[model samples]
Target: MPFISQIERQSDYSRFSSSTPIVIDNGGSYFRIGWAGEDDPRVVFRNIVQRPRHKTTGETVTVVGDHNPALLRYFDCTRSGPRSAFDGNVVYQFEIMEYILDFGFDRLGADQSQIDHPVLINECPCNPNQSRCRMAELLFESYGVSSIAYGVDAAFSYKYNQKKGICASNGLAICSGFMSSHAIPFVNGEPVFEACCRTNVGGYHVTDYLKQLLSLKYPHHSTKLTWEKVEDLKMENCYIAPDYASEVKIFQKGDKEAEEKTRCWQLPWTPAPVEEQPSEEEIARKAERKERQGQRLREMAEAKRTSRINELENEIRGLDFLVKQLEHVPENDVPAFLRDTGYASKQEIESNLAKATQSLRKAKGEQVENEEKGDTSNAEKYNLLHVPDEMLTSEQLRDKKRQLFLKSTAEARQRAKQRKLEQELEREKQMKLEEAKRLENPELYLDLLRAKYQELSEKVEQRKRQKTNGNNTNGKQNGSGGVGRGERLNAAQRERMRLLASAAFDRGKGEDTFGRDDEDWQLYKLMSRDNNDDEDDNEADLARVSARLREIDPTFVPKSETGSPAEPPGFRPLTKEDFQILMGVERFRCPEVLFHPNLIGIEQAGLGEMAGISLRRLPSNDEALEERITKSIFLTGGSCQYPGMIERLETEIRMLRPCGSAINIVRAYDPILDAWRGASQYASDMQLFQQQTFSRDDYFEKGEDWLRGYKFRYTLT
Candidate 1:
């Protein structure tokens, strides 16, 4: 399991005297605090703070370090996430630092008005003078401490390991922490800060890179790959490869060893419910319901027809009575009588009576014999037309001309009806011939029909592709960029563009004669955006072919009407494979960044390279000292706990040193806690604290120049 916060308050604070100094290993990743001379810190937690709102009380409260995520249900954490005080291993934000300090001291059982013990804390190597001054001011002014001492965490770890006989006095310490990695060469049991080198790539970069790559590869589970979770994953699975390229090849070929190394994290999922088929009785009940609804509709339609027939019969009787009454009235009184009945004249009344009689017969389900009546009335209807116009009066001549017009119109309509009947006969004959041919060879006929359908479909699709400029690779049309100024255009559009370009550039070359010829005016029509003749013709031809195939072939299924390729269904039942996160190459690829900082775009020397750089920067010119330093190289930090880290570092350092040089690498007893333990042991010496620490009065009296040049001695007895 990963490290959990030890925030249970210690109850023995009152037992210690006021002179006992407080040792704090203020690291970029964790904050450890304990009393001097102790074997372990009294309080340890992640160096982070969160200001979440209480769900019940609706007030913001500070939550420091990792808490029981289950208990967080009582708070609303949307506004503020966990925040750190360090910016790339430097404490620039003091406000957050203050919160972390408050939690650390409170957990250590400090109940006094202000912390009164002398404090010993660790800071990064070569820390800026401004940052150190601000830190001193905070401790002296806020905590009211009598004196404070600052030291490097890596130096403390090195001294602690040295006391344990892990390495000689002259050696190198490779400290790879959370935010950055450093290689500090120690001479005679003292850390040499002037010869140290740092690379801004460490455990934090590895975890972040893994999180990003996994989130992009499986975007649907991005929310599940939290920073804390990814950090845990990196610690559990990541390792330094002996040969990056060769090790990656094992995974690329999917070898058995790679499979054995792979880890799978299964997410939550549930199977979809199976659908049940309906019973025979249920299907019968639905059919009966539909039949009853149809019967009700038929009865209502019959009643409506009966009511309409009765109304029409009454209208016909009234019109016939008015026509009979028109014969008795004088011609002068007929106009007034017809006006009261809403008819213009006797002829109009007769026409209305005939139309009503025909409608009443049809509504009663009896066909009207209009064709027979027209055939019988033909002789009387054209009687005036056959009379000689010159031998009759002027009124007779006008009546004969009207009768001739009616006769010609009637004949033309009959001819049209006869032509329509002949065309229908021809279509029936053609269908019979095709049906006979199919009956003789059904297989051949179906093959021919399918081929015809496919050809027409392809032709139509090709036209659509040309119009769209064929950029629809994802099955979605190029809605915006297909026909823009610099994009591809169709044949007609290209020609039009060429014409416009010529017209524009031709004006400056010579005298313009744009509209001198009649044909030149036609250029505007060609450039019109409404030109769609080819599209319309293609659509009509496709429709005709599709209809013909559907009539001839029983197994024909036309493609979708939208012309675009059919898209897959949006929803699918998820399976175990969908939820499983596999770790193949990712296991070692993330940690590989430490040995090759350039892999993650960082241009600094890696941890291994930094060791060689540190050795070269030593002020000593003796080759014997360099050889001795390489013999006692020590790896001590939180990141040094990886499985193959020692081996990988030894190999890398050997490559950088001279041939046949002796190389040695050892790990600290407890990489994560040794820094705090070492500081606790060192701070136990009261006389050493007086020698290395500075009082607040000295800080002001000695001036800023004195503080800038201040150095701590780590070899104190």
Candidate 2:
């Protein structure tokens, strides 16, 4: 069963007499306090505190114990996390411990200037003298207590169990607390401190381990794995696998059992709203708007074109009139007539007229028909080509050479057009052949298409790799790009880097003969950055293949858009099972560590081994005493609540004892609170008022060390 804290303030503090002793069970995980003789503690709370700043007021406020989380909405707790007083079962930080003590006493209704009653507080086994003294001093000075008694919490539990006739007077008390585990053997109703064993592993370590593993497994939901929530998860679901490796193997194989074992906790999630497709009216509205915008743009463009055409037409008319006016003049007077205009000569005026007509046709969106125009003026364009060398002067020969160059250029343009027409015919023929093959067998056609696609993709990929390497080399040699210090470069890049470095330092060693030969100029070409742009067509081919595959194969997945080697992992929707941290392996694993500390990270011996160690420490190894202790093996502490704890301990202890030796173990009725109940009952006995319980004078004169040797007589009480 999951443990719940009871920390309600008690109103009957005045009902108890001033001489009544107060019982306090100061455990690492919890604190319980009550008036002497009470069956249960009047006040109990988690042994933790938080100092949070109020959000609205901006003032730091001290909040002790667990409070309503809703009330904490007004506070900003980011700066300070909930802190515990105990460190590995030892109260080290007195400042935090003081706050806890104050909260405990205040809730117990300590209204007087000081507490008038004596106090009985629980402590750990082999309680350090330094820690003991601090506790005594705090109670005496702060609470004004008459006297203080310190006893191991486990021993009190064992004694309480013994009173209920659960076990013999002599037995082992395996007490597992929050941060540590301990095993104490009770001999003749008294605990033997020398025989006690301690292991630095308990409920806290198990919860922390579960928390870390889960956070690593589901990094996206790490914030959900709070310490308190993980603690609850550990208690509710975690369990110890009898055989760890085999149990994990079951999960690894993903059997039905493993499927059943997996639990999920659903986090809050909301479905995204669905987008509705546009209605017919909406589509029509958008189309109308687009058409209107296009009409406006078209009109503006037409106005611009008309303005340009008009300007060109006016300029052509003026040129035509000037040429006509020049034609009216006599041939001998034409040069003088052209001089009146801007023209240098008759030929210059005719050339200006031709240029204006060509520009006007172009502005009007009419094809210039260059080939037709060229053919019509061929005789004039190459007039000197037909003239023989003997029929022309040296100046005429120069003009013939210019005509030959123009004729060759026109032939080259004609040849290029013929090649383009032939390519179009070849593509059409190939399409007909493919259609005939597809008609024979559709499956075979698809297979052939896929094969061709694969071949093209591989060719494109290889070309891309080669181009990338080439670009890296060019970049390295040009000193424009370098790999980061921690990054790795391609092989070509590394080689180019080496060559450039060697060339830089090779300068002063010999005479300058770098570009003496044609081969030497090739080095400049290799190092040039212009070579990197050559792969653009190859990348386009790869994109074509990828698009084709996507159209054909519905299941085909392209490489990641991130360009990384692998895709970044994303979080799947959390189910109820994901949030649940199953305790199958952890249940017994945590409690078992109390028996065998090596299971956890601790190197100390377990409870059973420690019992043997404790027995060996005794001055006299008496068989009867060992037998007595084995008969009354009382289990205690908050952590002794696992289902199979009694059976597991009994079996382990039996293995340690001699073959025929008797062994017995029993659990307390209420391991968590029985210590406080036992203390309260003991303090309430009237005969407990001995002279040793003492006057105030005895405490002052004897000093603190005198209080260290103080022992309680439980049998008398």
Candidate 3:
């Protein structure tokens, strides 16, 4: 398992004396703080901080190190994720560093206004003078430390292991830490910074590469690949391969061994509930209920029709009685009688009676036969149409024009009816022909029909794609050509635009004769918004083809228009494969970067090459010194905990050394905590601190230049 925080406030902080130094292993990935001479750090946590706004209070609060993720529910963490103080293994942001230090010291049970103990902290190899000075100032001014000592983390691990008899006085320490890797050569029980080589590739690069590859491979699950989760996965599964290329080949071939090596992380998923199919009885019940509702509506409509028919019949009787009374009365009295009946004349009364009779028949569900009677009177209806207008009076001439218009309208109606009949007959004949062809060779006929349908569908779809500038398969349109300055136009639209442009610019040019030609005037009509005949024709053709395809092909499914509703989620049952995150080649591929920095686009030499480069940079050209360095090669740091690291590094270093050179690879007792353990052990010695550390007053007098040259000797007695 990856390291967890040991942040329980120590209750016995007052028990330790003031002279005792507090040792802190301020590594890139984690922070470890404890009293000197302790086996393990009393307080350890991730070196990160987050300032999230409280959800309920709307106040931004500082949260240092890793906390229970459940408690973060009260804060809106979107504004700031977990931020580290280091940038490429160097502390550049002091504000974040101060927060980390405060948390570390608080967890170590510091209750006073300021810490009163001497502090010993770790720094990177060949750290910048500015960084070193700023750190010293922070400790001396902010924390009120009396004195401080800075030492390399790898050198501490090397010294700690040397005291434990893990390596000799002259050896190589290959410490692969969080952000970078280092190969430090130790001489006479002290680290030689001149001979050390640093490669900017380490655990951080490995985890980042793994996270990126997994995210790219499974974009849907990219949100699930959190940094902490990926770190845990790396520690659990990733191992340095004995032979990267060969091991990759084994997975590439997909053998049983590869299957055994592959790990799977199943995400949270629940199966979708299945819908139960209704039984015959349930379907029948629903149909019966619908039938009862329809029957009740029909009865209501029948009752309404009967009532309307009776009322119409009564109106017709009253109108007929009024017309009969008008005929019985004298011509002078008939006018007064018709006025009481709301009619102008006897003919008007008759017309009212006929309309009421026809309405009554219609209400009773009987046809009136009005169209047949009207057709029979066609000769009499157009009698005035045959008469010449010159022979008629003014009123007669108006009647004659009306009769002529009625005759022409009747003729057009008859022609339209005849054309509709002919079309129906033609369609029936064509369907019969298709049916006969299908009967003769059903398979071939189906194939031909399918091919025709596909062709027409593609043609229509291609036109749509061209008009909308959309993808045919995905149906996504490009927004670039949408109505603006550089917008695309169709052929006719382009021509109209060209005409408009010409008309606007032609006046200033030597072409003032725009309206002189008839064609120039026609340009105005083409540029008008009414020019849409081609678009209408294309739409008609597309609709006709689509209808024909739908009628002939039983399996044809039309494409949905854009912005339609997508399929509902849980449409398909959840499967195991959907949740399973497989680790096949990624298991070893991530860690392989240690031996090949170029894999992650880093130009620097890898861990293996750094060893040889470090030996080359040594001052002595003696082969015996080089042999001793190789013989006691030490692997120390968090990254050295990978399963096959020792074997891989041994094989890698052997290739770079001379033939038959005795090489011994040793691992630190606890690669991760040994650095802090070594620092704690070294700080416990009171004489060593007095010899190596500088007081706060001494820091002001010595100046930054002097501080830059200061080095802590690890071989002090």
Best by lDDT: 3
Model 3 residue 247 distance off true place after TM-score fit, in angstroms: 3.1
Residue 259 lDDT (model 3)? 97
- Model 1, residue 361: distance off in Å is 8.0
Q: Please rank every candidate by TM-score, starting with the best.
A: 3, 1, 2
Tell me which of candidates 1 and 2 scores higher on TM-score: 1
Tens digits of per-residue lDDT, candidate 1, 1-717, equal 121243577889899998999999999888999999999998888888888888888877788897878767788989889899999989999999888887788788895348889899999999998888888888878888878899999889989989999988999999999999999999999988999999998788999999988998889999999999888888888788888899988988997988998988888878677778879998899899999999999999998998898899889888878878888999789778978988865655766677788888888878788886674356655666667766889987887888888888988898989989997898799878878878999888778767776777776677666556654324444566444433334467667778776874484466577767767667676577556666666676677667877887666777864555778789988887999888878988888888898988998898889999999999987899999999999888777877888888888999999899999889998988888988999999998777999787787788556679789999886
Off by over 4 Å in 1: 1-8, 52-59, 67-81, 255-257, 278-570, 700-705
Report the number of clashing residue pairs per model: 0, 23, 0
Every model's TM-score = 0.72, 0.68, 0.75
- Per-residue CA lDDT of model 3 for 216-251, tens digit only, reads 888999999999999999999999999999999999
**Which whole-number lDDT from 0 to 100 does residue 281 have in model 2?**
100
Cα lDDT, model 1, residue 541: 60
Pairs with steric clashes in candidate 1: none
- The predicted structure with the larger TM-score, 1 or 3, is 3
Point out the worst 10-residue segment of candidate 2 by lDDT: 1-10
